[model samples]
Target: MSLRFAEEIILLALDDQSGKLRPLPDRALELAVAGGLLMELAFANRIDTDQKQLTILDRSPTGDTVLDSVLQTLPEGDTSTIRQAISRVAADAPDFKDKILKSLVEKGILNREEHRFFFVLKERRYPMVDDREEKEVISRIRDVVIDGAIPDPKDVVLICLMNACDLSSAVFSDDELEQHSDRINQVARMDFIGQALAKAIAEIQEAILETISYMGM
Candidate 1:
């Protein structure tokens, strides 16, 4: 069972016991999902990106619904500036998190439960049906970020997406994230597409924070 990049990230983001995400602002999770999609395209060689721009290398279907849908949505032109592409994709995918979670649930990797708060507000919780898959994801990330092992290109992409979303502490303990921060950052910078996506995530995060601050003020 080969999980897509987004699926792997979602697995790591969920708590093993509770299946809830670690405390993170909603925008962070949104950006993480967007980043996951971009990384998946990079892994499939469907896209290539540099500091300046993202180029569509292969617009053909990946045969995976989500990836192919995104490929189809790309502009007819071969390239868009990195920020332009990120903004377009992120804007186009307002329900990215929900879509990814739903896919995982359908695959039987996660179980979804609905609940109500005070019998008024409804919410959903996703618990892992099979934790072994999540453990494998953790081991792969640990090998690259903590063990100082050379990572597969896909692992490198995953680490970059995790860091961009501020998910290192969520995936590992606070102490462990701190201990491995340098190595994690080092690995994340190894790919040009990762670098571009990380920067785009940072910019989006900054914009979200600024909006929140202004609203509070």
Candidate 2:
């Protein structure tokens, strides 16, 4: 089965033992999933990006429902500023965590469990059913980040997605991230699509934070 880029990212964020994203922030996970969809479009050659803008290259159906839906809805034009496109897509996206989590459960990669506290408060947990997929993801990240090996384009994109989501601590300790910070950044910069996606993630995060701050005030 070919995993979508978003699926790969969702798997990477999950804990191999528990299948929960314990260390990653909820907000970051949301943005990362949304950004992953855009990255997938870029990978499919449906979109291209420079530092300042994102251009829709071909609006043809990617044969993937989720991706094709997004592509079909994109503004019909040559290009839009990167920030504009990012914000528009993100704002229009459905709840990413819920969507991706459901898909993972359906794939049998994770098992969904429901719990009730005192027979009232309900909670859900997704535990790993098969860990082989996640192991592959970790191996790829390890080869690039820890071994200092050159990353392939896909690996570079994954690294950038992980970093944008602040998920390094989930895979590596603070000490390791600090030691290899420069190297990680260097590898992440190898792909222009990843760079553009990272920028989008940052901008969306900032916008969310600002909104929260304003609401609090």
lDDT values, one for every candidate = 0.81, 0.79
Error of 2 at 192 (Å): 0.9
Q: TM-score for all predictions?
A: 0.90, 0.87
Best candidate, TM-score: 1
RMSD of 1: 2.1
Model 1 / residue 12 / CA error / Å: 1.7
Model 1 regions more than 4 Å off = 92-94, 116-121
Worst 10-residue lDDT window for candidate 2 reads 88-97
Q: What 10-residue stretch in candidate 1 is worst by lDDT? A: 88-97
Query: What is the lDDT, from 0 to 100, of the residue 127 in candidate 1?
Result: 89
In model 2, which regions exceed 4 Å deviation?
Answer: 16-18, 23-26, 92-96, 116-121
